[model samples]
Target chain A: MAMLTDLLVISAANRIIGLIRDVFVALDPDTAQAVEVLLYFLVMVLYAILCELLLNGQTLGKRIFKLRVVDASGLRLEPSQVIIRNLLRLVDGLPMFYLLGGITCLLNTRMQRLGDIAASTVVVRIPEVSHPDLDNVLGSKYNSLLEHRHLCARLRQRVTPEVAAIALEALTRRDRLDPVARLKVFAGLAAHFRELVDFPAAATESLGDEQYVRNVVEILYRAG
Target chain B: MLIDLPRFVNAERPHWQALEAILKRFENDPDLRLPIDEAQRFHYLYQRTGSALSRISTFASEPELKQYLEWLVSRAYSIIHGQAERRRFHPWRWFTVTLPTTFRRRIQAFQMSLALTVLGALFGVIALAIDPEAKSALMPFSHLTGRPSERVAQENADRGKRLEGRKTTFSASLMTHNTKVAIFTMGLGISYGLGTIVLLFYNGVILGAVAFDYVMDGQTIFLLGWLLPHGVIEIPAILLGGQAGFIIAHALIGWGDRRITRAQRIREAAPDIVTIIAGAGVFLIWAGIVEAFFSQYHEPVVPYGIKIAFGCVEFAGLIFFLWKGGANSEQNNSSKA
Candidate 1:
């Protein structure tokens, strides 16, 4: 879109300049060429400036890809930063393709191009409409399990977020497991959680391996 | 008692779907007003989703469902916490103030760049004078002119021809070409500045040889008239590109201070680098126009003496700009601020 606008600006300006020069000064061939070069340069530079200013750092292509240009530090995007980055685009889009820019992105932790590095800006993938399955399982935000204070206190001391993630993964992907695999997995998890604290025998007595995992998850993540 | 998983999922599906609808509404248009009741419902559903994500780990819930809630919550969190305000653009302040200030601050880097280029040019002149056949392994510009100045001189005498007065690429194409070459000088400098080193040397070599060609043909005075019309600005612009390239190479090689990471150094150097290179690109645009329209007016349209005189003025103007332009502005800025 930037290039398109640049092209339009150049054509429009050229025609207007031509009309005035012809009517007044009678542009020689040399003068006409000079005017063309000047207009092309102005349009090339201004296209980027105008597009970024109007669209908040999103050009036509960026908008199409659902990518947004934002400050890396999460500060509001500043015009100076935008100008710096857009100027550096000449460097990033080099050697026929974005080969240099691509290599830079691969090397940098934030995947920044030269312009991005200069501007302290990043191109982020906008978050999209997400799936609905989580609401079904964690229904109505009620964690009655929290009301069981003794069990909750025990669970907290035993479970870390990472370990709980493992338990969650195993349970959610249970259908993918072999019957024998499921039994061994749950048994190992039950042993792991049990080792964290010496819970009363009453909590363990009625629960099998799978039920033990579920009860532990409920206790660990219950709403406050 | 063990819960019937499928039965529970059936009963819970509507609430999950409803929560998704609310989050989507907010995500689609962050400023879209939500009534008080709907807002409370959205918050309630968000909390429920968070709780489900935690417990579903052990519930044998579908993996896809878990992923869905994870994404939804993360999206919601970003929307709530992230600053997404549209930025107001200020073209005047940035170009006039910030850019010049950076240019002034990076004077030393540009000096280093100038020193390197002069060294390369000296290398080209001396090496070619000694052995025209002695070619650097990487010499792309040599084909334009270099080494066999005697041969080019002979051809020029025999044909009574020179590239002077000959039209080159169209004005726009020439500007584009110059811009690409200058930008590449800065970009490829990342290879420990080696690419920049070679390219600069190669350019100087080509230039030295071209001069040799004209001189051997006994057209030194005329060539000066032709080249200086645009070279006054064009040469400096290319040199500015070389300076920017060296700055990038220095950042990559960790020649800079170690208090900051290499990335941070690049960030610091970038404004100055951009200021010079952008200036270079703008210069090339003017150079292209001159080469197309004025530089060619050497023999007939304009006298050679006057063209040479015009070139001298352009060169003197350039010298004044570079010598004092950045320094004066920096002083002015400090005083103003």
Candidate 2:
């Protein structure tokens, strides 16, 4: 995601630069050619240095591809390495297509292209996950097991950590289990704690066994 | 700290269960509220939920469960951010990304300018060839032609003596005339494309007539000496100036009434105008240099050959450097996105 954003930004910037160059040329065709050549050289140098050094070896294009360039030791790449990697772009672009480099990425486990290998960089997806409000968990717009606030409060107080852990494990493994098997696992866990808590015999059926187990754990934890 | 247990239970069993346990334990814990920035919050959510969510396909057999899970996620997001609505999409942001790509794609206009100039020059030559009398007809003065041969020789001798004596004034007048001509060519090039064509046509006709006049007078050699030195740069510079005019005119027309908002058009046209003005400056400067130096030097064969060589080099260089399509490999890569 970060790589995609960075690539989009860089692409936008490149277009602005190209437009400026065009205006210069339009103003004076005779001198615009020289200005264009100079501008191209400058842009190339800037791309190599900024992308390789400051950006940790990820050009806008590379970033969009969810890749980064790092040294052999998995550290930020050096300026010389960045230059070499970029210069090698011409080579990677050889043989009439990007076939050579594209094939390398396809075969590699980490998806490192020639440029990545040369610059010693790898691209990894960065994930995000952290919710701050625990109170809203039971009251969540998504929860349906406990409809009333009082019922949710009562269940939160009765739930226990052990039951919560078991419920989480069961839920995580739920995909591999048949519906009957999944219910059995939740019922079994709920049964272990049923003696310590007051609840209806059919509570596990109305409230999904997973939800039942989770409610038991939440109630126990709140009480403790 | 109020918990809506019903909605949580209605969500996908796995996510709901996992979330329920966490929320129940931390429900009343004030210390769980970490005062982190929004970016950090998003990052944390992405890391935790992305991994967990990736483990299971959210395609539940129960439609209510699927809807509940979607609602739960969205509600959680809203609670964290304090906003249920997404930010509005600003078109300018997209324009910024796309505008540059569009401007750089104007190699077509440059090619058109080159083609028009060449065609105009070609037609001018053809027109001059079809009308032999047109050359003398266009000349402003005809009284000097009525004099006898000897009298004309005497008059030329006297005028040459006078010109030698007042060299500074004569040179100043010539400079003034050249400056006026160059300026006129540059300024008139802005008449949509017509002005540029007219400039090219007139310049071409003048060139053909001068050459033809010298040939008729049996002084073709002298004509070559008189014109070639400066005509090389002068002619091309005039054509370029005219081309710049055509570019500006085309840009104005191309930006015509479109659904694109007014503000967007302004932003788009600003850069184009800047480029055209800059190019015009270059053309003017080159014209000044050629007029002051080359045009002043009325040498024989050497100067003529040098001028012709410069013209050939300029033509070839423009074609080579501005050779569209293949030069934009970097752009091609960016465009793939």
Candidate 3:
């Protein structure tokens, strides 16, 4: 998708170059042709270099794909790295399209093409995280699990933070889940939490699996 | 370790934010340097943020918060730990000093490049002498494959009128094409120098075949006049490209030193490789202009002696520049030390 978008952009730039060439061609044919060829190659080569340099290692394609080129050694991207890598498109784009690059990427552990290997850079997905509204997810509704103080304390102690976090995430994103998926997920969570501690029948019997998880999260998060 | 998560975040958030802002400034301007006090402060913030991350990493219930802290620590870590020098660029210093210094440092590779080309040229001369028909295959261009005397007659008769209107376009094409070839030749180093060797030898073969063809046809003056002006610079530029390729190959093969890994060796040589290739590119551009505007014109229009003299002068200048251009600076630095 990024390659397509970049190609489209290059095509549009070529059209503009053509228009500019027409004006020059009327005055000096040789100069016009020279300008056209120079401009064409410049646009093709500089597209990635300029974008990666100015945009913090993100080209238009990389931006669209939510990917960024970063130094494999976790250093700032140097100008030399950007230039050397882009110049290497000559080899990476061998035979036809990026067949050589693609195969190299697949075979390599870090999935770096020849350019990336030479430049010491890697393309990484920019992870996006949505902060959950803790207040809304764990509202003031009375938590039945909290009624049995001893069992609630044990549940909190036994449930690893990872499990507790997963439960919170499910509750926070519950509205976006499919009905069947929601039921299955909540059922699984409730079963896992139940095995951690034995809450009396009265505390959990009236609560549904989803509500039971809501009660468990409140106990884990809110101290009595 | 089981501290209050809310209080912990409240206490550390400001430091994390401070580190992020500093990192942003560093990333935006690579050449930016901080005062000693500010540098100390930056280090403090990084350490504090890293500590917070360790604390939060264990209590991983707040996935989003942990992710944010991890991101901050990572960005800070890179800024602090990167080993590549980030000095501000000075084009004059690079062209006169750094470029020559790097070339001289890798002189052996350049010699290897020269040897390979010479070897290939010898092969071409021998093969063509054995079978004259091989000229068609050896020098494939239509203009080149024909009899040299006929071509010289044609060039002298036309006196560059054939290229009168298209010189600029021709120059641009040459610059772009040669620059592309130079870069590709350097890049092929990743193929363990095998590809670079093949390309350099192939170029030499073409050069040898053409030289032999002209000499045999008794058009040596015309041939030298035509090739010398541009070939002096252009051939060396390509050799520089080959030199870079061999540098990369040497680093890959570890150069018989296992104290460092292949990656470290490549990383160490990368800056020099770029420097040599860029120098080659600059040379090729000049060669291109010369080839189009000056080399193409022949005897009656522009004398062969003048062209040959110009080429010799250019070659001498190039050798002197490579050998001693940066020597003064080296002496000053050593004396100061």
Candidate 4:
């Protein structure tokens, strides 16, 4: 929905700009030729500048919707990559409104539009909340109900220092993990902690080990 | 954390009763917010959901996991879809990348078009040389006969005397005629192949006959003065246009007895056709400028040399630049595979 809206906005902007340029040229025949050439160069330059600076490496519409452009590895996109991707829009938009491009994107695993395939970039949503920020729940209004530092010490007793450390590290660097690896690490830690806490099987399964681990951390932080 | 216990527990399960007992204990303890351990547990559960969702391959047949899977899928879909929306409208970055590639491709196509045109021209000249009588058959006799030639000479002298009064209609008429001829030469290529050949032959015969007439009229100097100035650029443009026509024909007609679908052939040929048309436009523009300004009033010696130099440049430029397809390196690597 956001991507579609962004596209609409950009298309509208393009049409408006084109109309303005046309009107400017029509006012003076001799000057119109010169203006036409100048406008073409100007439009190209403006497009580059707007995309690089304002969009977080995305174009104006992209920035508005909190979308980010990244490389195949999901790192920040390079300017050249951005350029290549945008330029391939011609191919994407070829023979009409991106029919070929849309097909290519549908066929690809990454769901790359024509430009993305050509430029080798991916568009991904920036996570709204980082894992570490979950710790802040302890400091919120619920602090009186739970103690954080004592719970951390209790957690330390339940699990080896090394295991706790690994869990903390995994959460801190969650972004680095592929989805599968992240799940495995989190699930393993949760299950281990659940055994130490000796929660009933019914509670353990329903809440799940991973959720249980998160609840412990949050409760401890609030109590601190 | 306000855990939604009812949503997760199956009422019929014996374990659900035990889970409710534990939940009741926590509920009675007014100070018991979710434990830190519990929060960590939930976090891990969320991560598991993400992982399971990501491993779409494993869940292909697991109908029981559909609801959980749908949740995960929707979240990921929203993220990606949102990102796409943001980037869709702002094509400047994409345009930057695409424009240069398009430009380079177009330029390369133009060069190929030029080379093919020269080859076509050479073939037409050969055809003319082989059948000299065809040259006379194609030539415009009104411009060549003694009385008409003498009358033209008188008119030229009168025009020179009253230079400012001379009508530009003559130049306009010539322009119109040349443009029509060029278009016919190019457009007939659509007739599969024969039309292109005929166009090429007609052009070659006319050029040869014109040269022959000038040489016979003891006005070789005048002919050089008149034709050389614009012929240099104009002739190559026409020849290149002819070449573009020939390429279109070749693309339409498969080279050998390979069974290829017409649609497949057209798709493969689309890029070349676009390139040819673009090249033709450029050539026509250059031809117009040359004929309008330079051809009508240039010194014989300089114009003749310019004409020869222009032809050589066309030949060298095309051969050096466009013959190697851009995918050659990729092909080499792929062959190793």
Maximum-TM-score candidate: 3
lDDT of 2 by residue, A90-144 (tens): 4344454557667778998877655455344455431222322335333333433
**Per-residue lDDT of model 3, residues B1-337, tens digit only:** 4555566677788888898899889867777788989999999998998888787665435556767777777777877876636777788999999999889989999998999899889888888999999999998798888888998999999988988899999999998899888988899988889999999999888888889889999999998899999999999999999999898788878777779877667667888998999899899989999999999999799999999999999999999999998988878977999
Model 2 regions lying over 4 Å from their true place:
A1-224, B1-127, B136-192, B211-229, B255-267, B300-303, B310-337
Error of 2 at B223 (Å): 5.4
CAPRI-wise, candidate 2 is: incorrect
Error of 2 at B192 (Å): 4.2
What C-alpha lDDT do the candidate models reach, one value each? Answer: 0.64, 0.46, 0.86, 0.48
Off by over 4 Å in 1: A1-135, A138-147, A153-158, A197-199, A221-223, B1-104, B132-169, B250-256, B259-264, B326-329
- lDDT of candidate 1 over A82-132, digit per residue (tens): 766666666676665667687889999988887777567787765554433
Better of 3 and 4 by TM-score: 3
Interface RMSD (C-alpha) of each candidate? 9.1, 21.9, 3.3, 18.6
Docking class of predicted structure 3: acceptable
Please give, for residues A1-224, the per-residue lDDT of candidate 3 as tens digits. 87788888889999999999999899999999999998998898889889988888888988898888888777666677787778888899987798898899999999899988877788887767666566799887777776677766566667777898899989999999999999999999999988878888988888899999998887766544
| Model 3: share of real contacts kept | 0.45
- Stretches off by above 4 angstroms in model 3 are A133-140, A144-184, A196-206, A216-224
**Candidates sorted on TM-score, descending:** 3, 1, 4, 2
The predicted structure with the larger lDDT, 1 or 4, is 1
lDDT of 3 at B179: 86
TM-score versus the correct structure, for each prediction: 0.64, 0.31, 0.92, 0.36
**How well is each residue in B158-189 modelled by candidate 2, as lDDT tens digits?**
43343333333333334334433443443343
Better of 1 and 3 by lDDT: 3
lDDT pick, better of 2 and 3: 3
Q: In model 2, state the lDDT of residue B2.
A: 35
Q: Indicate the DockQ of the complex predicted as candidate 2.
A: 0.02
- Across A99-207, the per-residue lDDT of candidate 4 in tens digits comes to 9778878898988775564344667664442224445322333322133344343443445434544555666676789988878877887777766655445434556
